[model samples]
Target: MWIDKLKDVSFDGRMMHNMSLASLSYLNIGGVAKVVCYPLHVEDLSNILNFCFCFNVPVLVLGNASNTLLSDAGWSGVVISLKHFLTKITVENDSIEILGDIRLEKLLAIASKNNIAGFEFLTAIPGVVMASINGNAGAEKCSISDLLMEYKYMDIQGCSHSVSKKDILCSYRKGPLQTFGIIYSACLKGEMSQKDLIQKSVKEKWEYRRNRQPISERSLGCVFKNATDYCAGQLIEHAGLKKKSVGDVAVSDIHANFFVNNGRGKSIDFLNLIEEVRYCVQNKFGVFLELEIKKVGD
Candidate 1:
């Protein structure tokens, strides 16, 4: 068994058996993860990857679970969550070096305390700093990639590479992680500015998100990628998918693009809702709607 193989490896980290993935995901829905490993540090991450890759153990690299959907049948392989121990953050005058798992909320506080500007736009974003960079998460006409200085990540083979901004090819809601595995750390630049200005910007951004999105609901972020000049929310709304439900999962009435788990939501319901929404949108507009969230498991 794969569990027996993991036991043979010398790992200075943590592991759980048949863990409920719903607890980790924002949607509060998912099935069991057969074997879940949490690395202690970067070296521990490499060790875990090496063991999994060498032993032919199926590896599912997960971070904050903000953009992931796990099937109800459960994951048959090892689920590796890198967030539990990747916790290092350094704030310098010119840059801030942060681990991939550090939350954006904490980074916002760090920027505020250090009088760092240009990070206020990130105050309202969900998940860790790397999540934003991985998906090129954006708002207010700016993206996390715009503020990046450089970043370091690990490939599936556990090899580390430091990439500069020029090397990183980021598009709207897309990032270099398409080819990469796990991000280790990033150095983001911030400028000195008036403290009150920073506070105002953060407040405004927070308010914008609160008003526009279903911030209080259980969702896996945006359901689909934007089409051309129109956002996914607009397309969904135009297709009359708002408030549409399948089982316990329903599209948010406040935002058409956000599919929220009302109560006891299941992955099957989520997938069904996606199909319904996609079918409607495509049939009406003749444009295929692509999913933004990553689906994992059986």
Candidate 2:
């Protein structure tokens, strides 16, 4: 019935029935999802949200699925992805207004072209702008919140609100938009810098990540959040979890905190590996590692 009714809704985007979540995720490890919808713009997205809310159908909004671990059991309700559309960037003096669905790579490109500096640290970061902002994603003691001046979001009831950065609470790996239903757009401010310098910074950051992280592998980014005063990767390596495996998934040898899928890896195996790593790190370092990757379904 839900599927039938979903078809009746006026949607201005693509939809797939019984879509495989693995195809959408960076880890490439998840079961089928009942429905996956890619809404083009805010109006299309709002319509889908309202329909799901009215029918009491569960909803999950995914960006790039870079840091998400979807279950093998699959999602029962609608899964909304904004990666296909809603990508618009406007440069206004020293500020940039970005739509939620813009990919980090695209954002960085545009920023560089416009001589916007300060986001060089996000050179090779996966996922879209919304997901990055949601997790306050960054490295080298920098974060997306650094440039964020304001953001706009729509609640579950499809009502939109704009919020200033000064009024929001943002930390190392968390942002104030968690409770909000969906972030539609954001304004980020950056310093006006020389194009050559920005490009050089971006290249250096990208190379640094490429050498240290298992960027080419199928992974869900960092598996654990760093403990206070300790890096998560160092902790995991110190715990002797490097190359630890369950099924086809294993802790990346390059980065101990990253779990990479070799091939046909199951979500259950990934979960098991997490437990194993957590136990090892806890026992060895007396720190119970906290998960940084978001788990969904099952």
Candidate 3:
């Protein structure tokens, strides 16, 4: 069996069997995961990946779980979390080399300390560096891809590769690595500025998101990507679906695109609300909103 073969692999990091996905997801909603592994280093991850590949077991790689929704039916494959692994950051003269697991908050503090100006927009993101780069996490002006110089990723075969930013295909809320491979590290360039100026920018970015988003609530960030012609939040709000509810989940009145878990919300409730809002928005505007968040599991 695959389970038996997994025991023979050389893995040194943490492992949880039959773990609850709710504990890992930012939405705090989901059923159990068959197995979750946290690799200590690149080789450890490669080993796990190699094992999975050889056994033909499906695999899912996740960072902070901020931009993903884990289904209630649960994933039958191995879930690899880089949140506790590959978290290293080094600052050069005007650039930064960061690992996958580093959180945006920590990166922001470090960048500000180093007088880096361009990273202030990251204050609006609540995820780790790799996932942010994978999703091209961004604010009004720019995305994470704007700061990237080059990135390293491991393929499904456990082989590592690097690609320069000039070779990367990046767009709003999307990046090249989203479907290709697992990113482990990246080099990003930023402008040198006064520390106080950087701090001010960070604070302003934080304040903007704090006032606009339901920061204190449990959610999978924005539910729908903006349509070609209109903002998803504005459309949902115009449809009068703000504060719309399904079981314990409700669309945030503060930001109609975000559906918050009031308490004890299930993934099903979130999914139901998503459908209802999508139907309402489409019926009113004739636009079918695409999901911004990644949905995992059956």
Candidate 4:
């Protein structure tokens, strides 16, 4: 279905059909995408979107897939990945402009190189720039939304638009982003700081994440969003759900909020684990756990 609609578009990036969905996701569990298209440039993306719009082909905009879970039944539409267009970073006095596909880790490194101080807390997040923005990704005291000044994105009609911080609305891990649109690039406000302070803060945060989370393992960063006045990890641990497993997917022993892939894990396993934990936490503490990760495709 998607292929027929995209036949007229000239795609320069990688293209795959019925590709293994697991390889593209952090959870490492999914079936396959009906069509996966990676556009090499903005023009290519525009062309594809135009074609899809004309033919009524469903499109899913994806970044590094770090904060998503794909269904085992796979996706029936077009999955457009922005990985190829991530390039260039421009640092002005008080802001940094970055391409949408850049990884958060790499972006933090760039910030550190430019002596920017606000992005240090994102050093350990494992996803692309757009994913961070789409989910308003963050931890502790800072969110990616806090640094965003303005962003350019293409709507479902293949028309580009710019949005300022005031035009956007976000809550926890959800934002006002449309699934059919693609984020092009964004500018983030950051304070210029001494290299020593930036390095120190980055190192401390990185070290804390390394010690607290199972960073080396295959895992979706966090499973559930913390409810007000309570931590998801703490509540799960207290409910005796730490180290719980469904198939090869297990709750991280180090962080109960993370679900790790031991080996050959499936999306069903992850879903089952989440449901189990949610039920347990609700029954024990009367608290409903909200998912921080986005589940895509079916």
TM-score for candidate 1, please give it: 0.94
Ranking by lDDT, best first? 2, 3, 4, 1
**Alpha carbon lDDT at 284, candidate 3:** 88
> How far does residue 229 in candidate 2 sit from its true spot (Å)?
2.1
List the candidates' TM-scores in order.
0.94, 0.96, 0.96, 0.95
Give all candidates' CA lDDT scores: 0.82, 0.87, 0.86, 0.84
| Location of the lowest summed lDDT over 10 successive residues in candidate 3 | 172-181
The Cα error of candidate 4 at residue 225, in Å, is 1.0
Which runs of model 3 end up more than 4 angstroms from their true locations? none
lDDT of 3 by residue, 42-96 (tens): 9888899888888888998887889888899988989998867857788998899
lDDT of 1 by residue, 15-83 (tens): 899899887787888899888888888888887778877778788766677777878988888787766
Show the lowest summed lDDT stretch of 10 residues, model 2: 172-181
| Superior candidate under TM-score, 1 versus 3 | 3
Query: Model 4 — which ten-residue stretch has the worst lDDT?
Result: 1-10
Per candidate, the number of residue pairs that clash is 0, 0, 0, 0
Q: Model 1: runs farther than 4 Å from truth?
A: 178-180
Of the pair 2 and 4, which is ahead by lDDT?
2
Best-fitting candidate, measured by lDDT?
2
Better of 1 and 3 by lDDT: 3
List the pairs of residues colliding in candidate 3: none
